[model samples]
Target: MNQADIVIVGAGAAGLMAARELSKEGKKVLILEARGRIGGRIYPLPKEEWGYEAQGGAEFVHGEAPVSKALLKEAGATLTHPTEWWSVRDGPPSKIERLSPHDLQLEEALKKLTGDTTVAQFLDSNFPAGEHDDLRNFVQSWVEGYDAADIHKASALTLRDEMLDQGSWRQMCIREGYGLLLKYLQDACMQNGVEILLHKAVTAITVNQNGVSIQCSDGLIYQTKRVVVTVPLPVLQTLQFTPPLPKKTQAAAKIGFGGVIKIIIRFKTKWWTGPREQPFERLFFMLSKEPVPTWWTQHPEPHTTLTGWLPGPNAEHVKNHSDEEILTLALLSLSRIFNISIEQLREELATFKIVNWIKDPFARGAYSYSTPESKEAVQELHRPVDNKLYFAGEAICEEDANGTAEAALASGLRVAKEIRESF
Candidate 1:
């Protein structure tokens, strides 16, 4: 049987970070990743394919991501900020208003919330139905599209905290792509003698007094003093524990795992910033009521590409659709938004790729969101069972950065500290 001091399941940001930290303390660390490649949801597309390093998965560095920022800096990656934001209803695209009267009222109501509840309940109680329909719709879209959360289950208090933290509306993109940062972490772990085995999907974990035995799908059993599971909540739910961690698995189910369908379309030219009646020269983001409600450009970087974001329930709606069907939907949405012909879009299209995280076997969903019960659920998961089975991931992070890379990195660091303290 293979042996190590600690074995980490999933080589994503959390697992990689944990391995690096534990290896620094002279611990024998082994990281097993189900996927052939590392970086989990942080999939960076080939630079040559799109003339730039386009992202296939996680993109923006939302708000003040201290952990992500520090890692980017260490990786020697440059950060670029998007310039403009626009929205469209029927006519031409226009600049998005930062705050409306309804938004102000919603903000005030959110501040008065004393207890945790679902976003849907909060909206119904405060905003009501008829007069506040716009506000309700906006809130629903924001919750579903931006946070990739379901309004009926997503925590209102958590959303409020996230909104307050994002009051500055600061977002940054890495010039070299997030892959560079992951490479840095992977390299650091390797240099510290942390062994990372790819395509080793962990099937069952048996914990005993002396140590723990991890069984992979390939029939390899690894004996380790401890195991850190950093997979997504959905994947975690499917993992088997020998002693049966009913509470941990049950808690994992309580945490909301959201889906996302990201569509990247590369064009032959920057047609959006063209000699049309109203040019989208400074178009950074565009929102509409189309099937794919959100779209954005690689603004400030002169890239001729538009990324379509269909998240949460919207993505789930088309989860079973084929790639061709999804691509057609994306094109149709863009055509309607730009008042351009679908044929013209086809002609201008250079290359395209669709990323359906909902269908990804290892991921199952994009990331985690907070439910009213998520705080307690996350707490339960954080407490290691028998001091042998520990959990660390974005879902385990019971903070404002629950859905971002920062959260994953922070959780990894926290678990590493916990393991070291135990030793």
Candidate 2:
């Protein structure tokens, strides 16, 4: 049995941040993690495998993420912005225009939205079907692909706010991968006397008048005055609570969780940048209507790697497929998009990796998205139970940063402050 002033379950970004903050106040904190390694969804691949600090999950820093920015600055890390964006249809690829001809009309319709509703409902009401098919497709693709959201459940108000907010348009990539930032937080936690135990999957949590007790899969038990759970929403639903948190459980269900499939392929050289009329040398992003519909390059960094993304329903549809099968599909999509033969791509292929977050037991899914009830759901989850049980994660965040690492870090800091205020 282990004892601590507080026990933080799941040593992800949220857990590590909370531990660091609490430890700063001279409180003993123990973080129990299910995975052997840390960083949670912000997974970093081996440098030797990709020649650079390749990210397996959660790559870009979205918008004005204050917490993420501060941490990167503190860690002496820098950010780089992608230079261009392109889209491919039946023929050649062309640069993407940020605003479409329907922008003014869409903005006016969004402004007149009176009540909360699903994105599907809002789009159907405003854009309709026959006349605005292209506009509808664009909006739906953006919601499902980029946000990994179910249009039938994602909140219209949340999407409206995000689309209108110019800050949300700003994106930057970590020069050395997001792993550096996580390492900084981990080091800070350790330096402050916080203990992190890996592969300690918390099975159950019990809270009573005598404080809280945590039981791990290995049968190890922890006794602490307070407990903070920062596990992903799916994992949280599985945890056994002695006094069942029915309201919190229901609130979690009200919020939306989505999945993603990320495929990374490294080639011997930048074949797409070959001497051609339309060179892909400066390609940042490319969108298509293929099985793997989205692709991007590490622009300005000069890496011979291309990343394929399939999110939301598309990812879920093929979540159970084998790695080789998915790789084949990726190749097919690339072949069609570039009008190149699969034989040529295979010849230049150095290595490849597929990241299916939905299949990951620890993660279950990629990230959270807002539904019509998300606001109320987040509020309910944020309410500490008996001042002994606390919850913190990206799902608990209700702001524009809801699905980013910034949400996780900010929630951790908020929970830490809440715990301190209780004392």
Candidate 3:
């Protein structure tokens, strides 16, 4: 048994941020991570030569969050911003149908939910035949990858409110690996004197009037004045809390997080049919499609790679499918869109791989989302217990910027400040 001023469970963005902040203020902080790696979901796939190119966790830098950008810059991580001009692969490059007026209406209606209904309810009432309707399917697909969830289970109001109006920064990907960014954050924490312990899964948390006691799988107990939990929302659903979580927290956990399964495919050559100036970098949104509602390609980077995403229920289905099956689905989708032969794609693509987050025990799901019904759920999760056990993560974010690494960091820092003030 050991004691510290603060204990953080799950060394993801939130935990690391909290530890870094508290440690800098001279608080003894210990971060216990279940996985061998420090970054919870932020682990990089081996290179192209390895089995496949998959991102275990995050892929995008997502907007211009100063906290994330500053951390990356401080760590000397390479970042490249896109130019003003960007193209959307609307129709097949050859036959470009004007962006439809009908589609625009639907888009606007859905976007208005930023302050209104749960995504499920909105789609149910608005879509004539409901969310599964073919017409609404397109919108569902394009948006799924954003939250890594199906539209039916998402929250429209949460999405819209958190939607970064910072126009130009909407679409961007990390030039390197998103995992690299996590590594940088971890390094920053270490430099600030935070101690990170890997493979130490926090199995139990017992809190009393005085403080909190955390128990790991290895039978080690850690005592601390305060505990900050940053595990994914879904993971919390399965955890056994002492004295049982309050009725509200239990219900909030039942809300459950949406699932996202992303497939990253690498090609040997640039086999895009679109013009060089028009190289396919758009979301490649299949507006009304179901299952794999959306897919897209990032220009020829280190390797000509096309990353496809399946969010929500479809993402769950993809996770159940084998790697070869996922690869087949991706190739079939690409062939149909670009009018390319399967043989052509096969020849151009050297290898393809899938990253199944659903199978990942640490991150049962990608990120947390606040459904119209679950809006208050997140706030409930953030409520501290006896000022000893606090929470921070995408699920507990108290802002429109919910379910993002930046939000996670922001939430963690806020909790750290609260603890500092109390001390």
lDDT of all the models against the reference? 0.89, 0.90, 0.68
Tell me the tens digit of each residue's lDDT in model 1 across 1-423.
147899999999999999999999789999999999999988988888988889988888877888889989989999987778888853577886552324678889888999999999998898889988888888888899878999999999977876665542467878888889899999999889999999999999999998999999999889999999998999888888989989999999998889999999999998888887676898888989899988999988889999999999989999999999999999999998988999999999998999999999999999999999998998999999999999999889965688888899999999999999998
Which pairs clash in model 3? 113-157, 114-157, 137-288, 138-287, 138-288, 149-312, 150-312
lDDT of 1 at 298: 91
The local distance difference test score of model 1 is 0.89
- lDDT against true structure, model 3: 0.68
Top candidate by lDDT:
2
Per-residue error (Å), model 1, residue 84: 0.7
User: Model 3 over residues 91-184: C-alpha lDDT tens digits?
Assistant: 4343223223135555676565546665656766766664446556554553465666556667676544434254412645566666667776
Q: Per-prediction TM-score, please?
A: 0.97, 0.97, 0.84
- Give the residue spans of candidate 3 off by over 4 A: 47-54, 81-91, 94-104, 107-115, 124-127, 130-135, 159-169, 254-256, 273-293, 300-302
lDDT of 2 by residue, 235-297 (tens): 999999999999999999999999999999999998888986687788888889899999989
Order candidates by TM-score, high to low.
2, 1, 3
In candidate 1, which residue pairs clash? none
Better of 1 and 3 by lDDT: 1
